[model samples]
Target: MQRPPRPSAPRRRMPSPGTGLTPLLLAALAFAITALLTLGAYNSARHVAQANLQNTFEYRSRDAHLALVRRMAVYEEVLRGVQGYLRGSVNISRKEFADYFSVLRLDESFPGIEALGIASIIPPGQLERHEQAVRREGYASYTVHPPGPRPVYTSVTHIEPFNGRNLRAFGFDMFSEPVRRAAMEAARDTGQAAVTGKVVLVQESGWDNKPGVLMYLPVYRAGLPAQTVEQRRAAIFGWVYSPFRMNDLMRGLLGEHSGEVELRIYDGAQPGAEDLLYLSPGTAPGRRPMFQRTDVIEMRGRPWTVVFSSTPALEAQRDTVRPLVIGLTGIGVGFLLGVVVWLLASERGRALKLAEKMTLELRQSYIRIEAEQRRMRVILQNAYDAFVASDAKGRITDWNIKATQLFGWTEREALGRPISDLLVPPDQRERHVRGFRRFANCGSGPVMSAPTEVTAQRNDGSLVQVEVAVAALPTPDGYGASAFVRDITPRKEAEERERQRQQRLDETREALQRAQKLEAVGKLTGGVAHDFNNLLHIISANVQLVLRSPNKQQQRLQSILDAVERGSKLSAQLLAFARRQPLHPQVVDTARLIERMDSLLHRAAGEGVELRHTVQPGLWNTLVDPNQLENVLLNLVINARDAIEGRGSITIALSNADLDGDALPDPEMAPGQYVLATVSDTGRGMAPEVMERAFEPFFTTKPEGKGTGLGLSMAHGFVKQSGGHIQLASEVGRGTTVSIYLPRCLREIAEGVMTPGR
Candidate 1:
């Protein structure tokens, strides 16, 4: 069967973008997605840029705080050096201090400090002496000022670099001011560096009256322990102090980089107008900055809050190029990606329409294909013949269930086997192979293109006749073959039976004529033998009488006796073949009987032949003359020995047998249980003509006196009369086998003797 061709789908054109709602929806979706992505990018860029700017501001603020701390520490270090200088000596001179101050180069090395000086801690009792000492070292007018009565006085005694500002600081009572006094007292008590908070230095000019601070380090008397507060206070001699203007200090600390950030220093943690210490020059007055950072630094045991702020100009200096470029690029890419998606969606819409049309066509094609398949299946399943297909090489490629039923082989078992080898009988396989090759070469053969009767093999190895028709299957590459076979075994068997019946009829007519002749001869021979036996008795008595009378013919008379005895044996054989001999029948175990004759059979086989016997277990006893059965075995073996011209083997086997009516070994034999004795020889076998007449009387293949040939005939008669069968099979090169099947006895007969055909 051929498959129906599939139908193709019709193409449908996509609608224009302006005409459809789909394009508008896709455009809107693209716009929405792009807008969201652009906004997200911008926000991310802004956050990152702001964070970098904030970090820049914080770093600058920290730098400003560290600058302030380091400047303050420098001034304290100068003070401590002066304190050490003062405390190392009992008396001091103006030139001696000037030399020390000149070595410092305070104007270049340490800026922001206005002057460095010493304040002596004088008691009210020694105030006059301290004033006299200071006046001796400098101007004659110098005296401790702000002369209120107190228990102790800290008076500035020595100052440098001896400028106009240094003159003003000289002889000033620093302990009289609260800010300066607090710092000095702290220094005296703690024996550490201290600084005054938001002080107006006495040395500041009226035009430059900015807030200032003072640092003090106490110098105690030599050889005094200042480990405790009380000891430090008790041992305090004078103070080494520096005066500073906050504005100048910050300017000196920040140097050229001071404009990078706006800075303000407060005297304490809280910023106020009175406590404001310094502000950078670039800061706008009274204006807040864009970014601010604050740090509290510890100076001389006090907390100074330094505030650093980033102005607009400072923020502009921070990096902003990367975010700007990223934001623009993100918007551009988002728009391009959206456009691509829109175009793809448009194309997908056209493809979807085409696919829908194709689907409908495919659905129709599938329906047609399914219907065709169902029709083919019905024909293959219901047909009585077997349908088989094979490739050009004769390999079976397809087989239906009917093929399985006919060949006794399953589809799985048959496929892929060479068809000729699988189905053709051994004798016919070569011809089948030749036919296959002819068909392959020419696409035609005697068997192909026509129905023919052939013998085929079944899985069980039985041969069956079949009517087969083979046809070439046209293929693109070449040609294959398909066969339709119907089993004709039953009809062939009927024809065969008819042929055999006709042959049997002809043979039976001939056998009846031969029997009539043999029966007449047997009657004549019996009459003569009976008269001869009477004469032999008379002759034997007369011979004995003659011998006793000493006659001259005695030797001749003995030879006559020998000849008579041989004649008698020959007459007995003739009678046996004619079916007229009396037999002693008994229920006997044939296996035991054969076993008893083993030695005799071996001896009869002669020296050149090997004789063997096999008796099956549980053999049934047969109703036959035991003596006759022995004779039959001896005769068969002797004949087998003569057939072997050289070394050969004789095998005698006894077994029980049951044959059905259809499968009986001999047509003349009744179907029943029988015990079979088979004697076979590996020797020169007989031709078909000799095998056919092997049981005829006196039909010998040997030289004149070597064989009677009546041995098989006599055995045949005895078995037939005993209700059994005797059959022989031989192949020219293979060997010869004779089988004697005797009917099993159900019970022993009381008759001691019985005549055949009686």
Candidate 2:
């Protein structure tokens, strides 16, 4: 709104004599300070990177050591199982022992076991007799190996699978050698497992030689005193032992463990070339490790020294200059700022009005930028999902509020930590590294910017299910990454619960349909059986009458009468299955009913099946035929006995359950208080398809001639006719449980009744 100044010849102001060099001096000072700052920042960054490298090396070393300990412990436990098997019997034959060992499937269970064998201590006198006994068993070429005998010779009498390289160890005299003899003696004297020192295994072929060790678990004569050292040595029968090759052993123990950490194992407590059992492949000779640590792990009383060292690959990562890149970026920005200040200071001779206007504009711009930054921080802090950004080296650069809450690591703790170490699970870190490497090298990676469900780690060492959307960020130096992560654990849990509920719902519906089908079959069978019974009655009467009147045909008529009688009996069984048998219904107490059957039920279950009863006091009463109920219980116990193999237990548990309107156990059952009598067996369970048709007539899982297949069908008919619902539940290896829910007697009584399901 102000009038423009009149145009005039611009005055060429002369530079002041005192201020002439001030701009140059200020510019030089600014640059010098900036250079010093940049140098300090770079040095600090390098120091921090070195510190991180040391920490990473230590972590990997500890991990490798722990892994070795765990793998060895598992092998020791397996040896214990073998030792237990030997002590369980006194006369274990060669075939029996071989079959037992074959079940172990050593390669699949634990990859490095060279052989599991039994070494028998051969007194000098019994050598010929032992050879004769082994020869009779089929190893014609078997003989004591190494062709020498000590005071007490021990030969591997049984080693399996009797094929492959394991065959080479057969008849190998272990007690003749000092290393093997020492471990065997340790096991016998201490009555505990022991491991031998480093040795070339007898199982090694001529083409290969790997450091090997043997684990020995002593076996003593059954029913002998082996508690003390002298007693154990005297009664010791032999030892169950296994051999291991260190190269294959370590490979199995430490799968895909990165080469950043070099592993070396020594057989004894000290690390020496003579005692070196294993040296990890790819270790650069003469390349001194940047980080090294030594620890000893005791293996079955034998100390194993493990050495872990950092290699050049680890050093390369530490020398990446990522921290220097970050520091320089920051310092360069400050340096440029200093140069701008120098330039502004140099323009002091300009118009005061214009200078004031430019200063105001800069102040406004700075305020606006600061306000925008604050706004951004507030938005990030309040975002719903966790937000994290990392540099190309996978170092966390920025973290937001949601990330802090989700990961349990505060912003300060997570800022410079590797993203994989902080968030990626231990098992998945390799994949994370590969993805980042691919993006950095090829500028492309796995489906970036698309949400993917993955497992993530928390600071507390627990895991979380997260859906993360990652985007690659191209920077001046390399590729970086930003991710939005949402915790999906709650949603996954909800889905699981819903899935289970739906499964249960489907099962109940299927059971209801099966029950309806059985009911229809029962009605049809009952009508047909009734007509057949009437026709048989008439035929029997006519045949008997004819037999009385005839002489020559009397034998044939008598045979016809016998045939009719058998048919009539079969019809009676059919009527029973149909629940059409005549019965006198009476009020029965559920608990008292089981109490009266104690002797009868036990006799039916036999000694193998431990019969048990759990009768709930004050059980509800139901109206059912007393005799029919007794028959049902006896049949159930007998059926349960047949269902079980060897020793098992059958429990008849009685409890009162309420089937309310909200969630009736079955659609066939009305809302009411019911008496539940559950007959559960620790026996072979039924498959789902078998359980569905279990109530059908002539459906049996038993051998063809063993059962009539009418037991469950008749029982089902009896329960349904008595106004009850039956439910069957089973798992393939676990067991089976059958429950019968009978409506309580409407009339009031002091005691109650129960239904059966087995």
Q: Write the per-residue lDDT of candidate 1 for residues 90-207, one digit (tens) a residue.
A: 2587788888777666776566878888887777577777677666665799778886787667677778887787788777888888878898889778766888888888887889
Q: Which numbered prediction scores highest in lDDT against the true structure?
A: 2
Q: In angstroms, how far off is 750's CA in candidate 2?
A: 99
| Regions more than 4 Å wrong, model 2 | 1-26, 88-91, 323-758
> What TM-scores do the predictions have?
0.41, 0.42
- Residue-level lDDT of model 2, residues 348-406, one tens digit each, is 43235445754664465456446544544554565567878888888998799999899
**lDDT, model 1, position 437:** 71
Q: In TM-score terms, which candidate is top?
A: 2
Quick one: RMSD of model 1? 58.1
**CA-lDDT, candidates in order:** 0.73, 0.75
Clashes of each: 0, 6
